[model samples]
Target: MGTTFFTPNFQTSPVLQGPKTAYTKPKTREGQAMGNFLIDLSIGSFIHHLYSASNFFKEMVVLKSNEKCIMELSRWLHDRTGAYDWKHASTVVAELEDKRDQHQNIEMRLKSSIRQVLKCNFEQENITSPVELPLADCVVSGLLLDNICKNEDEYMKNLEKIIQLLKPGGQLLLFSSIDKSYMIVSGERFHSFKYSENFVKNAFDKLGLIIDYCAVQRRRSMNECNDYKAIMFTAAHKGE
Candidate 1:
């Protein structure tokens, strides 16, 4: 939402701790490291500390649904001037890893790991149909599906599309805002889909995904948006 979700300027912002922590978890890292390629869907502010996977994957492809997001990521990856300030997020990541002084190195690793930035259309059955993105060893998508789809049916279809992008037994990292209908971005409200934990788990089960890890962090206090009650993180693997 206009970089609001990725900025860590505020001390209370969960963007730094929530996602980075989930991504760096020992088991998650092990699964991610099993492959050489990663495909990131809806690459928002998640651009920061991407180095978390630098050691795991030889190359990374970041796919976004909008032109603006793609442009923002490209600027940051190339170290352009107008890119969003990700130092705060990167600092937190360094501290979490007990390498606070090596923050710059971590940031650089993330930048180098990314090989391409591309656009995707989730509404279509094959998100990158004409372009034909390679099926990846891992796919990470955060807060994209619920915010983009209008209804649950569309959400399910798109979820399948994302899974189709992964190789068998490949890992999928997902982050979602639970029970949210709308969020404010740059002073304007954006629509979001609402769903419960059961609904999410049922959908994943129906898709034959093996859930390896799941966690939910409830909102501590209302900050920018009143749309979500909790943040949901899940890691699963595609069936063989």
Candidate 2:
């Protein structure tokens, strides 16, 4: 399973320093990034979205679900060792922004945009208790609920919890795993709920969120480390 992570396969290989072709840079909002405060939940491990977001958002709040994840992200913010190199990911983001030479500027903007990093528990009633968070103009989540949620019911509950953190008419950006039952991290096995595209759309629909964009990618490559067959990306906005 260890050897499966960085294999030649696109689905298994880490996008960090792997083949550029394997990395699929998602589309960002054109014209202007519209958000005063962007709240990101558990997207710390991958900072690709931050680069694109820094352009529009003045402030960013990172809600980490665990201490270790916060520590790893903090290492990168502090320029310490052991932090995963996200230069490649940011570079691709820069190109997408039509500023190929401004990758460093993008990084700087990202650092400036991030205002808060708090550790919270998703299982708790109030994800971030004691500290009241401001309603955000936008919210971004990366493979969070799928890993921790035991079933669709729990997933729905967590979705409502996350929505409460966003302002009315605010947007939600979700990066989810589709049809995945397990994932491997640091040689440890983690559980992931298997869900389909329809499942996700129905979840959001039930919450009254308007879906602006949605797609699911089924990777041709396979690996033994996890049972993920596809990845899902959704951009939706809350009703005013």
Candidate 3:
């Protein structure tokens, strides 16, 4: 038998709970833990959707444009593992070794756009281009340094931009850190200004996105998020 976690409804349900599972424990090694975790967890979330085929009416697109995350994920799964199609993802994973690079990872925003276009067999996906999109069914971002939105307005504007991209009935899944900083394997600090729930609430409110759920989870083993007060996962539903 295979591991299954298909949700019947996408109504802001709690997909993951406490006792967060680390995707990988790099243990100071330049590891492939993230690549493996990405392919696996990424698929798990989708397979759950596939199983909920009866409820998944609209098509999906991700928005992760960060260079490090976008590029690395691209090279690993598509060129390297062929993430275009989910067949034998496990097999492809078995062949890779942990070799993540600071520059190798792409931005977190480009991911959804790429996949949206790829659905048509890597066809030209011209959805998220010049001028920005104001309505989408879903948006996903690992707001790693969430603490930096100190100015409040700047943060809300960015959040508003993202919310605008989502459709009224769409969902926005955000993964972020609760602290103001992070330390990558290189011991480099990814710092941002501190933030509050009020700030987050206001951002979503300005964009007319309603909060559906929030979860505090353990950092993926691949992540060295051990120093954070908590890892936040928020599922917001866009309002009309």
Candidate 4:
């Protein structure tokens, strides 16, 4: 098993578009604006989703489970000379919004909003243990739980830990693959925990989170890279 990084196909997947919709489509309560602080704990270093979120959040923090991922993503965000080319992802975002020509501006905005990158271990004894970091108004995670957790029990447990990082009334944006057992990266197969949509909704309900929006995109085409039946995007909020 090798470490999985962002690939062009993964970046262009329909499921990957869920974050933008989660951020932009929902209607907030009257006079209520989006959050000031946002934290992203997605599995890989791919940041295409952040471009949409950068427009709303005042500060963005990226948490990675490993130091290597942290260092790589940090360099990509801060080092201009050796930064990975994110223009393609930006263009996809722009096209989604029908603003193809403004991709450059979008890219710049995402780069500016990122405040820090830190290390996190989701498998800790007390996953919800207090840390020096402040609670975020919103936490965004993509394909993280399924990748890290070994079973459904651990998945739900880790989900609770992630929610602990949010403030009361804060929201959670989650992206997951439905019935996905594995994904191939660079011709290497990596394990992905399989779960159903009902399981996820129930987990949120059990935790007392109110789900605001949900979307599912069934696999429209076949590819040898993965065996996911569908992708699910959910936006839920914790009670105050």
Compose the digit string of candidate 4's lDDT tens values, residues 1-240.
111111123233342343222222222232232468888999777787777677678598888887777877877887647766767678767766578899988887888999888778876754434456788888989889988988978988889989988899888889888999998887899998999999899999999889877777677777787788977878888989
Locate the minimum summed-lDDT window of 10 residues in model 3.
32-41
TM-score of 3: 0.51
Write candidate 1's Cα lDDT for 124-209 as tens digits. Answer: 77887578777888888878898888888988888999999999988788877899988777688988888998888998998889
* lDDT score for candidate 3 against the true structure: 0.40
Residue 205 CA displacement from its true place in model 2, Å? 1.2
TM-score for each of the candidates: 0.85, 0.85, 0.51, 0.82
True lDDT of residue 25, candidate 1: 24
Instruction: Give lDDT per model, in order.
Output: 0.74, 0.75, 0.40, 0.75
Q: Which stretches of candidate 1 lie over 4 Å from their true place?
A: 1-33
Checking candidate 2 for backbone clashes, the offending pairs are none
Q: 41-70, model 2: which lDDT tens digit per residue? A: 854366665676676677998889878888
Score residue 53 of candidate 1 by CA lDDT: 61
